[model samples]
Target chain A: EKASQLQTQRDSLSQKLQETELRNTELECQLLDLEQRLENRRLESESFRKSLRSLLELLDGKIFQLTELRDSLAKLMESDSS
Target chain B: EKASQLQTQRDSLSQKLQETELRNTELECQLLDLEQRLENRRLESESFRKSLRSLLELLDGKIFQLTELRDSLAKLMESDSS
Candidate 1:
């Protein structure tokens, strides 16, 4: 009587453990997927930063050239005015 | 007799299930953290893009102004020479 009851409990608990382990594996897979996605996003962000930096450098170069032109123009105007 | 064996088996499997549940909870928490971190990085990336856009607009404006200045200077020189 009591023996049969214990046997049944043991079987039920073993089943529960199996279910739990299966669920654990599923969660692990999901975490791995999230990690991979995050890695890709990080790479994308890094490339964006690199591209922006180069663009800013190019704009800075253009600004420098324009400033030089402006200065020369100012000098010419000054000579003209004088 | 057999009751003792079954009871022991049930206890051990119950313990395993408990431990597995705890680990599962921990994994869920970690996944939540990764999601939050990814969200933050995405927002940061968006802001960076916005900043770059505005900077490019400002640089375009500067270039336009410089070109205008250059054109006027060129006209002045032509008149001066003529």
Candidate 2:
């Protein structure tokens, strides 16, 4: 009877082990998927940052051109008045 | 002797179950941490996109102002020559 009880306990433990292993496998898969998603986000953010930097540079150039043009207009107006 | 052997088998299975449970716990913790990191990345990306959209709007306004200024300068120059 004691041996039968031990056999039952062993069976229960084996079942629990199987369930735990299955759960572990599922968690591992989830981890992999999450990691991939995170990597994609990092890449996307980097690309966005690069594009933003270039756009800022273009704006700077346009602003500088505008300043020069305004100064030229001012000088011409002053001379015309004189 | 057979009962003794069965007891040994049960002990080994129990030990394996304990180990598997421990591994599952670790994997679960890893999953939680990864999920948090991914959420942070998403929020950061959203913020960056918002800033980029505003910057583009600013650039458009500047360009429009520049065009107007250039046109005024051109008209002044043409009238002066005439």
Candidate 3:
């Protein structure tokens, strides 16, 4: 009877170990997928940053040109009045 | 001798089970942390998209104003020359 009990306990532990191993594999797969997604997102963010920087620079150039034009118009008006 | 062998097998399996269980717990913690980081990254990306949209709109407005100013300057120059 003691031997039988030991066998039963061993069976139960063996089953539990299998289940845990399967769960570990599943979790590992999920983690790998998540890591790849995060890497892709990081790359996308880097592109976004670069695009934003370019847009901001373009906007700055436009504003500078506008300011120059406005000053030229002001000077033109002053010369016309004189 | 057979029973002793069985007992030895059971002990080994039990030890393996414990190690697997610990590893599972560790993997679960890592998964939880990765999930939270992904969520946070998602929120940041959303904000970045919104900011990009706003910047584009601002750039559009500036271009329109620049065009108008350029036209005004051209008209003034033509009238002054005439």
Candidate 4:
């Protein structure tokens, strides 16, 4: 009788352990997915920063050209007026 | 004899259950931490996107101004040539 009871107890424990192990595996998978999402976000942010830099440089060039053109035009007008 | 054996089995299962519970709690905490990290990354990405939009608007305005300046200069040159 005692042996049978012990056998039953062991069986139950074995089942519980299997369930816990399965749950652990699921949690680990979830953690991996979350980390991957974070990595993607980081990359996206990096690309945006690069885009910002390129845009700023392009705008600066345009501004420079405009300034140069305006100055030359002013000089021409002054000479013509004189 | 069977009763004593059953008691022993119960004791062992109880111990195993306690240990499993502890491990489960730890996994749960880890999962929470990972989720928090994901949230922070999402926020950072959102801020970056917002910044990009603002920068694009500013750059557009600058480009428009430069184009206007260039057009005015062309008009002045044409008038002088005529």
What tier of docking accuracy does candidate 4 attain? acceptable
Model 4 steric clash pairs: none
Docking quality band of candidate 2, CAPRI definitions? medium
**Candidate 4 local lDDT, A1-82, one digit each (tens):** 6677677877788688778878877877887887788788778778867887897798689779978988997898788954
To one decimal, what is the Cα RMSD in angstroms of model 2 from the true structure?
Answer: 2.6
DockQ (CA atoms), all models: 0.80, 0.79, 0.74, 0.43
Q: What is the interface RMSD of candidate 4, in Å?
A: 3.1
For this target, which candidate reaches the highest lDDT against the unseen true structure?
Answer: 3
- For A1-82, candidate 1 gives per-residue lDDT tens digits of 9988888888888888899899899999999999999999989878877887898798789879968977996898789954
Residue A38 error, candidate 2, Å: 1.0
TM-score to native of every candidate shown:
0.84, 0.83, 0.83, 0.70
Q: Find the 10 residues in a row with the least total lDDT in model 4 chain A.
A: A1-10
Interface RMSD of each: 0.9, 0.8, 0.8, 3.1
Q: Is candidate 3 or candidate 4 better by lDDT?
A: 3
Candidate 1 residues lying further than 4 Å off, grouped into runs, are: A79-82, B67-81
Structural RMSD, model 4: 3.5
Selected candidate, larger DockQ, 2 vs 4: 2
DockQ-sorted candidate list, best first: 1, 2, 3, 4
Local accuracy of candidate 4 as per-residue lDDT tens digits, B7-59: 77777876877787788788889889988887877787688678878987987
In candidate 4, position B77 carries an lDDT of 75
Question: Candidate 4, after superposition: displacement of residue A22 in Å?
Answer: 0.7
The residue-by-residue lDDT of candidate 1 on B1-82, one tens digit each, is 6788888888899899899999999999999999998899889888877887898798789779968977996898789954
Better candidate number, 1 or 3, judged by TM-score: 1
Worst 10 residues of 1 chain A by lDDT: A73-82
